[model samples]
Target: MLQLIIRRLLQAIPVLFLIATATFFLIHLAPGGPFHQERPLSPQVLEALNAHYGLNDPWIVQYGRYLNHLLHGELGPSYGHPGHTVNELIAQSLPVSIELGLWAWVFSLIVGIPLGVWAAEKQHRWFDRVCSTVSTLGLCLPTFVLGPLLMLGLAVGLGIGNVCGWGSWEDRLLPVLTLGLVHAAYVLRLTRGGMLEVLNQDFIRTARAKGLSGWTVLFKHALRGGLLSVVAFAGPQLSALVTGSFVVETIFHIPGLGRHFVQAAFNRDYTLILGTTLLYGALIIVMNLMADLMQAWLNPRLRVSML
Candidate 1:
């Protein structure tokens, strides 16, 4: 398992490098400098700004310089902010994003797993139908739509939670709900499908014949295999949530890495853009690797395939 993990991490390096190369060039190719302003600067001032940031160099040279800096753990200064480095900005914001994502992940699992199991147990019944309908609605509703509705219904209507901004626990509830519900919908469907398949196995019948209570048979005997799909789905979603939800964060006015990524892109902050991209890219790779490992552990046959 350790060997598999090490191998996967090694494979991720080139994947990240190609991502960095493509992202770096595409961003620079876009028609705007980080220094571009509606109020044009004097040519000499512009030239000085370019030189200071090493933007005066050819694209290849600049990319090489950036790579060199990256190796030394420097993401370069933020062009949009006078004195802030891209690394510093991410360090400040990523924790908030991680916290938001973690809560949402937990929420999704708590709600989704049980709902899915119950729905599967009650398959073809009204309860199952209702669960399916709810999951569909969850799938259909984008964050932009759901977030406002939650705010309008809960925050403004019932005064349940704060509408926007991030400071206290109250401020985070809506955004977390908005994010968690969507993922929960995904998890629910996956869990239901996995549960249906697992429950049909001969082992489930044997467990039932042993006089195991329905709850024990379902939760203990069947649930482990039933969760395989959900486990597989969680890897990328974990990274996505942790990195931040751009729309959800924007709507909720949460100061997270996703919002910063969008701002950096709009501002054409080259280093900041690459930094966020790298951060997300790395997270995704690591998360997927973890998921793969978990999958292998759950099904020993998969460990053979991992080789």
Candidate 2:
């Protein structure tokens, strides 16, 4: 397991490099600089600003300099926002994003897994049909549409919570619900499918033959076997959840890395933009590695051979 983990970490270097390269060039590819909005500066002053940020250097030289900073755990300074470092911006905002993500995942699991179990156990009945229809609707509804409608219904119409601003935990509810519901729908479908397959297995038949109660068989046997697939689904679903929340965060006025990423792109804050991109990439990679470890643990053959 240690060797496997080490190998995965080592492999992330090239992936991070690609992410950094793509991010750096992609931001520059867009027209104009971060100062494009500022009152036009004298050419001498502009040159001085460029020199200050090392924008005066060639692209290769700049990339090398960025990589050096990255190696030393520096994310460089905020381009236009003086007296602020990229690390500080990230540090302040990351907790918000992570908080939102953790709540979203927990909510999805709490609701989705049970919903899946109910649907799977009640397959072809009204309960199953209702859950299927609801999950389908959730899958179809994009966050851009759902976020506003939820705000209108919960916050606007009922006055349950404020519709905008991240003032407190109350302010986070709508965004969390909007983000979690979508992923919950995905998990429901995956879990239902896995459960259905597991329920048909010979072990399930033997358990029933032993005269075990339906509840025990369903929960202990069917669900336990089905969990492998559920955990596998979680890795990619979580990555999607984290990435998709960018739109949700923007709409809900949440101060998170997603909003920062959007603002950095608009301002062409090259280092900040690249830093966020690499960070997001690393997150996805880490989730994938966790998935691999989980699969190995659940499957004895994989545990013995792969890990």
Candidate 3:
């Protein structure tokens, strides 16, 4: 397990390098500079700002300099946010994103898994049909659309909560539900499929033949194997939840990394863009590694093969 983890980490170095390299050039090659604004700066001021941020350097030189700073654990200063390093901004915002992601994950699991298991158990019944229909709608609804609809119904029409801003539990509820429901739909489908497959296996028949109670057979005997797909999906889903909250964060005025990431891109804060991109890329790799580990743990044969 440790060897597998170490190997995955080692392999991530180049992947992250490629992501960073690609993002750096793409953002730099974009039409405007970070200092570009409605009011034109004096050429002297622009030149001074470029020199100060090393933006005046040749692309290759700037890349090399950025790489050097990266190797020494520096992410450089934020162009949009003066007097703040990219590192400090990320440090302030990452926890908020992480917290939001965790809440959404928990909501997805709680809502998705049980309904899926029940749907599988009840197969062509009314409950299954209802769940299937809801899951379909959930899958079809994009966050941007669903967010405002929810705000209209719950916040605007019903007067349930504030329309925007993130602070109280009410503020968090909409965002969490908006982010979680789509993923929950995915989880529901995966879980139902996995459980259906598992329940039809010969082992399940034998367990039934042994006269085990239905609940025991389902939960104890079949659930572990049934949940294999969900476990496999969990890592990437978690990372996506964290990094993909840009829309939700923006809508809710949440102070998270995603909001900053979106602002960085729009503002062309080169260092902040690179930092957030690399951070998200690294997160994706780590999450996939975790998924691989979880998959191996769930299947002993896979674990042995990994060894």
Overlapping backbone residue pairs in candidate 1 total 0
Taken over the whole model, the C-alpha lDDT of each candidate is 0.93, 0.86, 0.89
**lDDT of candidate 1?**
0.93
- Order the candidate numbers by TM-score, best to worst: 1, 3, 2
Model 1 vs. true fold: TM:
0.95
For 80-185, candidate 2 gives per-residue lDDT tens digits of 5788999998888887888888889889888999999889999999999999999999999999999999999999899887777887877989999999998899
Model 2 residue 246 CA deviation in Å: 2.2
Instruction: List per-candidate RMSD values in Å.
Output: 1.6, 2.1, 1.7
Question: TM-score: which is higher, 1 or 3?
Answer: 1
lDDT of 2 at 225: 71
Give TM per candidate: 0.95, 0.92, 0.94
Candidate 2 — which pairs collide? none
Compute the lDDT of residue 102 as modeled in candidate 3.
89
Instruction: State the number of backbone clashes in model 3.
Output: 0
lDDT of 1 by residue, 1-307 (tens): 7887888889998998998899999999999899999999999999999999889899999999899998899999999988999888999999999999999999999999999999999999999999999999999999999999999999999999898888999998999999999999999999999999999999999999999999999998888899989998999899999999899989998889898788889989999999999999999999988888888878778878888
Better of 2 and 3 by TM-score: 3
